[model samples]
Target chain A: MPLGLNSPQIVLLGVNHNTAPVEVRERLSLSGSNTPALRLFAELPSCEEVVFLSTCNRVEVLVSTNRLDEIRESITKLWLDRGKMDSNTLQGALYEYHGTSAIRHLFRVASSLDSMVVGEPQILGQLKDAYRMASEAKTAGLVLNRLLHKAFSVAKRIRTETRIASHAVSISYAAVELAKKIFGDLTGKNGMLIGAGEMAELAAQHLIAGGADKLVVANRTLSRAVELSRSLGGSAISLEEVGDALVDADIVISSTGAPGIILSKDQVKRIMRPRRHRLLFFIDIAVPRDIDPKVNDIDNVYLYDIDDLKGVIEFNKAEREKEASKADRMVEAEVIKFMAWMESLNVVPVIQHLQEKAEAVRQKEILRSHKVIESLNDEQQKAMDVLTRSIVQKILHDPIVYIKKGAQKKNSEMILDAACSLFGIDGLEDTQKLQDKCLSDANQDKTIRKPSPN
Target chain B: MHKFLFQITVFIYFVSTVGFLVHIITLRKDAERIATVVLSVGFGFHTAAVLMRWFVGGHPPLVNLHDSLSFLAWAMVGSFLLFQWRCKLKSLGAFVIPFAMIIMTASSFQSKEILPLPPVLKSIWLPIHAIICLFADAVFALAFCIAIMYLLQERQIKKKRLGAVFQRLPSLETLDAMNERCLTVGFPLLTLGIVTGSIWAEKAWGSYWSWDPKETWSLITWFIYAALFHQRLTVGWRGRKAAIMTIIGFAVLVFTFLGVSLLLSGAHSYATWLK
Candidate 1:
């Protein structure tokens, strides 16, 4: 028979970027004003605590409840009714994890290992926000509070030990990285943007952050260039003066949609002779190739098109994937440790039952013997009571050690069931209430050492 | 006794080579530390064997194929270790230690008997010329390793086929900078070696510029690196072009050191020292 404590199990139901489309996810996403959702979850049968996490890519509900079936059905119905989505269409889109698997999932999500980018740092902040909202709404209790704190520590550990977030994984980031490769140091260098387009402006911002001493934005329209440059604390120049401007600029970022080549080999070659000491890096992130390809042949010139930036992003993605596996191992280890702690907790109630049953039998035998031996002195009766208690204690020692040791190992449920049967323990559902009381008492004694509700 | 020490050194180097290769494949940080330790042990043994040979033979041990190969391996390991200390480039040991192992293995196949020094070689310039030339070759070997790594990193970045191997290697910027450093330091040492050798040549052979194949190839190697330096200083060839140029220069240098002595007939065809 299964060990019966009627304790609440952790249940997690979610839809992430991989499982649901943006439209479906948005329909389920809860805002900070999620009092309605919180009230609905709190009213669910047997739900002791709940936390709802909603972000652009995912919407998750984590709950601790004994009636898993009732909570799952109620939450599914509530989500479907709110979204007005057909159950058939969204049937296989939702994922549900329970017990240890649920806890592991929470840790992975908090650490950003389950993110779309694998290593983005935004998920931790979003998780913290979800936790805070749950706290304010009175939906989170002792169980979830502890779980969330543990998840935060796990996330912090993974971030400290891995290079998952160290590399650039975006197109704009790749452009900056390439500039660094050429110049060694971006400080004390001049960065010039050839067009006032969004991509050029983004690259200009990255260059400025990289410590470029000067920024020059050049465009066909002088007013647009000036407006963009002024906002970034840089100067603007007309496109006609770009050739002369190239003499001082160390890095050039071009993303104009013009049909013709903006910079040619002869133009760059002519400029290189006058500025022979400086290296020229051309980031041509344009469709029709703003900078001429032949210009790459010119001395001291390095040109990278959009395709090159894509390569850098791909490489960085692969690197993050490698680090993800290391994070996975860490998550697995933490899950095992948490499971062991839970198992030890489940055995606590069984141990209490066994000891209490033995004490009741010993007390009855002692009181009966005291009446039969009323001729003896009160001191003699007390000595007999002490003697029986010592005998019972000596008999209980080996069994207690055996059960506690078994609880630390795997498959601790079988050991707990055996102890309950051997002791003739009954009414476990009633004992669950006692277990809950004792858990709160233990938590009061030491918050981190509380019995697992499982 | 020295031969036994040389064998042990070779075995240690082989183990270190495996260690570094595993570090590259697995990306285990502990493997890097272990490999460096093993390589240092091998270097210590190799140094002991070389010193023993020098003392017993009453020379610098530059008399035969075996001695020259052993000396080259020693120099390669020494320079690579020095670079590792300065740069902490663990991935680089994957390339350099294995190259040293191959040279040591080749040296093991040659006869271990020490041959008598030639009467013509009995001069103060002998040690000076050989030591300086070997030091130049060792520095070039490091440059070659960095150049190859630069090309590999550049290829992965360009082709977009990055895997675990790509991540284990150093960044393209780091490899490029290290290559440039090799040139800045190595070129002067090479120029000094050639100048000292030419001076020794005039004293010994009554000529400063013999058209010997080794001397001619050495000049060609020098010119290749000179061209590299010129382009690097004047035009600032930064990434891929610079890497490819250094690779080409390394090829000519290898040919000058090995091919000219072993394949061609010349006064400096010193491979017959064993015979």
Candidate 2:
């Protein structure tokens, strides 16, 4: 069946880390458990399907609608009303991608290429959750089903082929990486978090995730330290016991807000003496680093300050950016595949029309021959039917193949024109006015492949 | 015929070296495959040349400096290909294969005549000692190359100016692993080489403890590597420091292998320049 000029068009409009600040994004964000995707589907007139993706970094609404610009405006207004903000205030925060670019954007998002920390694995899971929500709400139809599944495969390919997600791109992650470089593995290793601050806690989380089982949280405030330790399921220690903790710690992350140094070079040297120069990694992410800078001069004591961690993160970011170019090529190749499939959709209707016209003519001729032959029995009738059907199929075979190949190349205009004129099919050329619909759809599509059939 | 084959091997190594160099420069994908295949063919011909020399002379060709140099180059190429296959580190070729080319080029300048083997060189332990030492040397050469790459990558990471070379090179973790792997394999072979050479020395010279310059320098190189491995095991000396120490150890070993025999007189001084 040939889709008319009103085939479902893809429209994407939302706020991302790049397009909006966290404050603005939070105002418009949808919770995963209670997404208003189905409500959004009901609210919009022309929208056929909707999938809303809301994460800590981005909030995107992907919809299939025949009215692209109208739905885009409606979505922007929806965000403004939902945010309770003025139009001008929320105007620049929302970015829109339509048709194929919208799909490419979705692919990039699912692959984590569009993430704040590119190649972080969480976005794929988050996208999957959003997809599941849309599926449950029945707001995702055939177009979205194919697009999302294709996106998942693209994400998987990007993850496997490139080292985008293999390296750490955050300060806490860099601390874990340095620990690996020092200890080779963190299993059963001891880690100390000095200060129980947010940064210290984050580093501690990364360490635990990387298999450092033994953790000690130390801070000047004993109660806060104890609280943090209880939350993280680790033992708590007072700031005074940091030296004692340092002796057993293979990885130490200190992010205390204190102005002076927490561990002096002499204290570190003393700790080293007992351990006989065991490796101790210190990540001082505080503004004024907790550990003395000279502590790095001590044997087996590796100290990396915030700036050093930043350097690691920056290097990793550059590496991911390089990998993104490779991902871009893969996405481009996939888009070509998808566009070819879509162009093949155009050929489907023409093939159906040509088949219909041929069948109609075959039926009319058989009836006329049946009336002229009075002695034709049932056996002879069966043979004549087969003979006529085989001739029609043979005549239609070459033209069908030629039309399909031309359609896949998107050179369907000349071939469709020639085929329609040769076959004397009437409604298709008038439906060529409906080519305006296909033309507009193709315009919204990046690889339009034609100007006009007329 | 053997000499002609040897020359062709050297020529092929030169071409392979150029191909790898272009791979690093252009970042072309097929260059590594082409270069590796070419280098393997060269290694095959070099092997043929060695076997032909062995059959014609009625002995293994480890008699003099000329023969030893060619053998060392052949060992380096063979081990390089082996490691390259094992690790899939084609970029390492850009750093290591040049040593084989340089050794073969230097070998070409030396005497090619099949001289009579000295009575001292006739011991079976001579070939064993030489083979183990050359194998160890080949591994150390790869370690040196990886160490160089590690330092370059580390500098780029530290300076926060990751550019073309940094992208072409492997990660710090990968380079460090290669260095560690080489040390793990090379150190034991070096121990065996030293042990075999000492037994041979005891038989030939009546004393195994003579501190000839080559013997003294080889011990020095051995101790340097030993200390490097010890620090890595106990104190976790790795990354930039580890890389730097490997490079230093390679330099000392090169001096022990070539400089001692060429520039300093020793009981094992058979590798003097051709005259």
Expressed as tens digits, the lDDT of each residue in A309-366 for candidate 2 is: 8877787888888888899889878866765665566667778888998999999987
Against the reference, the lDDT scores of all candidates come to 0.80, 0.80
CAPRI level of candidate 2: incorrect
Interface RMSD of each: 4.7, 5.4
Cα displacement (angstroms), candidate 2, residue A168, comes to 3.6
Top candidate by DockQ: 1
For residues A176-221, what per-residue lDDT tens digits would candidate 1 score against the true structure? 8777765657888899999888988888889889888898999889
Residue pairs clashing in model 1 are none
The lowest-lDDT stretch of 10 consecutive residues in candidate 2 chain B is B266-275
lDDT by residue (tens digit), candidate 2, B60-145: 88766768788888888888888877877637889888878888999888888887777767888877888889889888988998
**Model 1 residue A119 distance off true place after TM-score fit, in angstroms:** 4.1
Best-matching candidate per lDDT: 1
Give the TM-scores of the predictions, in the order they appear. Answer: 0.81, 0.81
Ten-residue stretch with the least lDDT total in model 2 chain A: A445-454
Residue pairs of candidate 2 with colliding backbone atoms: none
